[model samples]
Target: MPTSENTFHLGLTMAGAVSAGCYTSGVIDYLFEVLDLWEKAKRGNVQGIDQNLVPKHNVIIDAMGGTSAGGMTTIISTLYALKGKLKPVKKIPENPMENQNVLYDSWVHLDDNEEKTFKKIWDVDDLDGELTSLFNSKVIDAIATKALDMGGDVNDFESYVSENLPRFISKDLEILLSHTLLRGIPLSVDFKTEIARRLKNSPMHNTFEHYLVSHFKLNSGNPVNENSYLWFNPFKEKYSDKIKLSTISTGAFPIGLAYRKFDNTQFSDEYIKSVTRRVIFGDFGSENPDVNHDIELNNYPENYSSISVDGGAINNEPYREVGSILRSKFHKDENEYQNYGLIMIDPFPDNDDIERKYKEPKNLLKVVPAIIQTLWNQAKVKRKEMLEQYNHDFFKGVIYPIKHRIINGEYKGRDKNPIISASFNAFGGFLDVNFRVHDFFLGRNNARNFVQYFGCIPYDPDNGNVHPIHREWTNEMVEKFKVSRRGDERIFLPIIPDLNLLLEGKEPGDDKYNYTYKGKPKYNPSELFKLKDNIYNRFKKVLDKGFDSFGEKTEEESETPISDALIRREYRRNWFQRMGDNVKSWVVGKFKNPVKKAIASMLSKFVIKSILEDLEQMEVLDDKAN
Candidate 1:
């Protein structure tokens, strides 16, 4: 049972995306600001910062979870929170002559005379550019140089294809595969190297559990009960080297695509193939590896046979982990109005995929890659749907979903889901400092907007301090606010007075209405009528557009909700059935990943071969024409 002092449990779960992690960093930065935690955390860790370690106090999140790129974000956020440092937020100075503040307005400046400022608004910044430069120099540039030193560049394949039009048309792709294989080594090495360098001097370099203790009771100076610091990372197999490898493991693409060994025999052919097979087919020990056990590399040679890959490949969203934390921690409370809730930051919210319609294949062999790609994408969408259904069934009212706002700016480009989609083709914007600055501000502003409308319901649901948006029946707040369906965007509604009640109140002393005998419609008759009328109008509008009011559909206009009972029944297996479900899940898990792996393997092996075969046929036809 939770103590009165620590009654509430709040968890934050972040979803994965590659370069879009900067947006999540911005969201966390704003959350810290809202909680007023930076100053309090920093005051306790003056010495820790000097040693380049995270601070030891003032953490507000009870449980935190993330996967893939979100795994990197989670680690970086935890480190910065402990260190009391904000992720760099700065835009390039513009219009120097018109406004000097625009010229040199940033938390970080280019010169020694300048100082770093901690401002609430992240409009100005030079620190972000400096960090990007460091990442380029330490990681990106190093990988490019290594690729060149290997006797060829990945771009050489494109060059070869363009120069030999007849060969490309004929489907010759020998040069393509040769270039593709060279990319894996350099990228993996530099990524791991950069991650290591960032965390080299950290104090708690073991399990996440050891690192995330009760910060408020650090040295026994305070007399508070130990706070439950529940944390979940989908990157399995954490050991003493977790500090160096946790983020890398979670973000590693599968089947040795982005894997690097820190051992002397890393380059051997047999070693590489063995690790590949192990990752694709073998298990990562158990669903939850013993958190307390430290598996030493040398002693556990068998355990080291398999390597960790992208957590997104298995569990892109950490919904299950977070749900478990809530269940285990608060099951004993038994209160109808529980003081526990989860806030989810979803980078990839469900959207209708604009799938391409391919013409009938001239040859069946030519269609394998297309088929594989479709299946992979479909699997991801299906997985998200299943998770959404499960959460809706079990934790609908408690879970608050926060979708990242579309990055708005000159560089916003075509990618609406900037939290997950990397718009590589965007003009000078993505490459410019201002683009990243916009992402930081985008996440910050999104968080600000989210807090204004949604929050955990107080233990006392009625007469509690609810946001104005939720206070429809209150006398003071009734005229000021509106309530919309869960699916619709919140909009204001006009207040409709109960004329009968108003007239009855006007005649105070008259016993004509028999006030004591009749109940006054339990609050408001006109308000209920107005709400029902609004729903009918919305339903009618959808019907006129030829869309079924009862069906689920995604449109350019709005999202229509489906039947609630259907969603609830889809993924109903819960704690009561955990014993039987675990066995069933284990069996399904065995074949699920290998099926995905087989599709990926077949695509890689056959696609280039088919191209080459077609190229030869084209060459033969040219000879006959000549």
Candidate 2:
């Protein structure tokens, strides 16, 4: 959140890396090279050239480092980057992704050429997400209905389209060149996709609502005594079972990761244990958690979204004929694709072990920390410029206005920044700042709770209970955590609190399992907890009974939902309190930020946008004057 500064550029490049949007070899390589440079930059060296972090000679590298244009305007802007004079790379592509509204829209169009251009690279999937907000809106349907009619004034009707909608649709993720379609009407693809999302949101989307209401077996009240946003995180099926994409639900706006089924029907111990295992090892590949590398994927079979597709299992037969025909012969130990059962539906690339040196593991807890460190390195290396933009103290002016507007809530309306909105809708938006901290900031728990919170799906059919951040399985590793024993990572019970504990810090008894504080001091839930609610639990319960029939899918399980009213009350109280806290923060942060400072800070974006807008307005004024 630090603002960018010109005089002393600390780390602005990080931003570019953090959310560059597109994923390509070029961007990836650039990011990696930048990280290499960053490692050197920490010592102010680029190819043995050590200077100030922002040296006049490093202009091109620094300029290209972020998503900015380098024309006279930004060239003038780069005057800050220069000590005084070095012929700047005066000509820059005028269409920078971060600037320009129409350009952003162009990217969202899909099927444009030059996939890397911000507009071309804009990811359409995110835009599809934005349309989801309108699921409850009757207006979109009316518009769609009218559009289908093909009779009325399309232009006037077009005006009915919310600014947020277009922005969401046209978010160009800034890819370079690829067969991947760029900005164009995806009606052929989109028509059905849009319909599917809406269908998912329907209350009647489930088959067992009657059972849930009638039986009331899995009934749960909001776990309110515990501070949390969602009462339970649901799942779609049992662990090691088929992952049902249909039941998955999107949580929060501008999300990351894929869709999740936030229903929480799967609360059985089995479910919880599986989730824990996956969260820890599954992500890094469940090898010994010792050998750290892509090689860990060696034993890991390629994703088999289906079975029976590829002869019911992996075919080890090499494709030397095809490879030879294509002038690339296959290695005896080359990767292949595997097909798992109905639990998976797609043929996954196959990878078994041929046993390379570092292609193995030696420990377990090292897995979490290893992943954390790796992401941290990558994030810092890639997005240093964006992250440390204010290192030179140039950010005071840039961020003030954003701070003010956020305080003022001016951006509650979507059109304020169409590009940002669309971009978020497509890429599932930015990762939560807390997650960013987890990714980069030196920490141990490694944003574990945040990941659990985000990755967990609610209405899992395997276990008929909703377990948000559920501890599904207790392995030796987990038990090590429980006893606070020294696990492989040189320690256990490393004071890593679960989401519930983080939300409600340990009380005297809770820590000791005594339930009530004995002779020790009592710790209570704080103001933040007051704003916590179990609305997630309520919503998940309804979804579990319906979306996946998770609760009743098994003969051993009974679908019971917790009290809706009770849960709603807890959340309402929590949310209301949170609203108050936010208001307070806004009031304090806004006034403290001066308008000039805000303008100065946001001036890059504001001025960039307003320059042409100002000219247009001036002409209109002149016409009126005439």
Candidate 3:
């Protein structure tokens, strides 16, 4: 047996390697959810390029000359510097190519017609006037859609972003100067044509770059012998430089840029919409990550129109009604729940003289489903916790009375009663931890599976140690808490000295493997974690399947699987005491219950007061120049 000191330290080091797997599972769930929605949308042959498959709170609008409720998040972040938003500390380097003083109305564009929307030019390169207009109108989504097709020329993107970007910066460019609404942003770095040719044949770093192969999903699962990590953190030390935190748009779905091409020149934006406006069934993309240009799509919940393979225009009476513009893109397997949706977008009509290409694929819509679920579910779960956590001990210890007196200007004290108390206000609080989709492609997982390490760190009211809102804490915190408390995880980790190295055909105790854990040959530590995850997942599947004995299970099932909360709460209470010792709670003697009237009155006060504050400080958050 290993000594206590060695045993605990050994556990921590070992768990780190396998910790990613658990996080990966969570992230993969989101990835699949996103891919499923996008694939379905693409297969359904959805119209607009801005269709979002994620969950958001914004109203769906007709922007970018079409309809979409999402993508603003990505556009906002990418255009952040365009709006002068300050970057967070220790974040990726900011792109200094464009000005940060402008802001755009995200919901509306300049005009539908290209000529009427004639924009000016301001680029170092001579790509001006009509050419600049073409790029902004053609390349930048600006207001309407948010997907970028970096297909034809990586050089064009490199130059546009590097040199001529100022040309497209509109008058109102500050729309994204604040925290954006979209969740995860996928940055596209296209490798095609000249770009592909140069890199594929390069000799010096070609071998290393080749090793950094692209990972794809859509296959039921992943295969070994490939670079297979899917749940990726752009913030990871190894790939931090390659992953630009500032540039990662919340608009992107998959963490990495997907590759696609428009095969026909006639398949212009207006033509495709007008052409398939009434089509029934269409194929778009498939479940295979490597497969594209194979799927087609048409309106769903409507009759599948007979699409002529020769394909020019629809001749079928122009009266076939597709029932509902159903969210046909959510190609979820039975196991995956409909956590969120991909909005069906509208297409632009041919009132504009823009060259229409029905054959060539102009833009691609990406999906980050697990992130959608993460944000959506967090909103729900965190909202519940916020309500529950407060309600349980709310209006206690006369804090409310003291605060009320101060708000009404009745109380005046420096130390005892601060004039402005942030305790009651939630303006600046740590975001809830529900690591939705931290990374689309995690380590060696083929970028298909979503992954994130979640589950709240142990908090002690006596000790002010707590988790910050909306941030990913270090794995070290979890390990410390787990081992300190002898958690099921810490207790269960097996003894494995060189578990990771063992995979490389090296024997334990040969190099750094010979190290002792208290006294024992550090047993394969990773096996414990693998076992734990396997056991947990198996149990989850069992519960999801409903009953142990098929239909024999009743509504009041004899037994229920233990919840994380239950275990932690019980432990806390047993170790100290619930309702009496560990937690402090007090009941007010003169508590009034005109609860309805007071609640309504309070809400009215909050709204009016908040509006006044907003009006007074419109530029409180304005960005200062560098």
Candidate 4:
């Protein structure tokens, strides 16, 4: 048995499912709930955990890995956790991204006034003209300025810029900028530099110093191998220059998106020559094989070149990476291994039955299903390998398998398959119900199953009667567990209000059950207040000076429309007559319900016919004059 001094490691793995947008949202919501639950458990607010299951302390994540969108989520979650911003909150909103205040309050925290400032920047009543003006003033002007400096034609540069920076930026840039700004990082000429600087200066930098973002060689002919892999450690002084740039480069998907390239100066002549100067970067998933493989045998290539791709092509789930790192560090002792726990959050769509409903394989919509199936198959293979490894004493009984539950709503003609049902559920509800289902499943089923599966009770061979892990709980039990008594007054606020309302005695739509901040303030006063002021001041400066100096528009004076006397006279007569007839018909219809049909008929013929005749005569006159 391990002593109290020995601490167990917890590895977190996030899975890639690029097309499963809603599924990803559900996964995020699930993560938020888990964090909240963990916080409660640490404070002794929750009761599901038995003595054997309870950690001596709050379990710290030893390692974290992810691929593609999963990678992005992992980074965001890790940052939040490290910053101590993973607070207990309300249930996740329908679109987690849109509800930044709740899902990512740490990243985009706003005061009452800051909210108004952001609204001013983003709230465009005339979307088209404002958007067009914004593009011309910002994107077009920047490209044009850079092009002129490089002695390139404006037309050619515009085309190139459009190709490199497509419409996706229009959707994503604002949100990204908003996040960066909230983090107190200013937008500069070189964004990568600013990001690197911010990372280095961040108080939580030590927490993520060992973080790795895996990339692959895009131009490599062979499938992803050890040589093809390029692991980026952003905190390392040597790779610091390219770390932030490489992270984004690795995430840039190849399909329907431009592959990123290092500005020519970043590469050495020899390095450039070796790769034939074809510098292109794509998603790490392009090289992810998505199978269970021994990471011990793999090698990291010595050279750092320009070409890179997604990790999903080789491994959508990077648990192998986390496992390998742990094994390397503590392979000598079996007891050491038992101390660590691994939690993988896989949101990839993995249903075949629902996919089969769509017969056309070549259609654009089929691509998502195909990717889901491929990733699902990979996960299955990896799960099988994990079970085999456990039997062989490789994992040493550390692995816990949870069955995937499909959460499709109870609707007629719904696909019965769990995978398909989950996908449809995620897609149709935009992750609102999907998140609820995910939380419910974990509380009601997965938690109990996990406890039973990994219970410490020894099996009796005499009568073949094994003592079951007593993890069963009712709605009331869960509610009781969520309530915390730290002071004179018990804090009955639940992390997820909807869950409490639905499961507990709380009334439906009761806001009182919602979580609220009442203890010591989580944020530092100086940092929080200063960061907000800094961001707002910087934003105001940018707006005043314009995004770029060139292509600035001056307000134009309004002009009055030229009206014709004959047309106005004819139009007024038609309008008044039409209004009068409508009013008369309405009054007649109201007074005589039985005779309404007769009145409508008379109006349609006598009133509508005259209007149509007059409109035809006006059209003839207008056309002849033209």
TM-scores of the models, in the order given: 0.40, 0.18, 0.18, 0.37
lDDT of 4: 0.34
Misplaced by over 4 Å in model 2 are: 1-34, 39-45, 51-92, 96-272, 276-626
Q: Estimate, for each residue in 242-313, the C-alpha lDDT of model 3 and write its tens digit.
A: 112212221111211111122123123332332232121221121122333322322221222111110001
Pairs clashing within candidate 1: 55-82, 90-125, 170-614, 170-615, 171-611, 171-615
Model 4 misplaced stretches (Cα beyond 4 Å): 1-6, 19-58, 92-247, 262-307, 332-337, 349-626
- TM-score of candidate 3 versus the correct structure, residues matched by position: 0.18
Highest lDDT scorer: 1
For model 4, residues 118-155, the per-residue Cα lDDT tens digits are 22322233233322221112211221122112222233
How do the residues 1-626 of candidate 1 rate in per-residue lDDT, one tens digit apiece? 12423344455667765445545655665565544432332344222222112112122354555765566556555434333233333232352112111111111121112211101011112123211110111231221222112122223333433342221011110000000121222111123355566885533233110011101111111122212111111112121133334444454444312432232122223333322222222211122233453232221123122334556654565544554445554534333434445666654454555796746767769689778767656534444445555443222221111332223322323323332123321111112233334444456545544432234222123545442223323443332222243574434321111112222332211221121111111112232233333323322332322222233465665353455566767967688698778877788668755654454445434433443343233221122321
Number of residue pairs clashing in candidate 2, backbone atoms closer than 3 angstroms, sequence gap of 3 or more or interchain: 111
Candidate 2 per-residue C-alpha lDDT over 1-626 given as tens digits, one digit per residue, 9 for 90 to 100: 11111111111111111121211111122222332343344354444432321112111121111111101011111111111111211122233222211212112221223332222221233332222221122221221222122122322212222221111111111100000001111111123354565674433211110000000000021121111111211111131011111111101111122222222342232322222222222221121223353211112112211101110111111111111111111112222111000000011112345785553445887677778756544522323334433332211110000100122423333112211111222231121111111111111111222112211222232444322222232343233223212343222221112322323333212332111111111112131122122212222232332333322355564344456666776767677888999998798667643543343345334422443243233221122321
* Local error of candidate 2 at residue 301 (angstroms): 27
lDDT of 2 at 626: 15
Report per-prediction Cα RMSD to one decimal: 27.8, 29.4, 31.9, 23.3
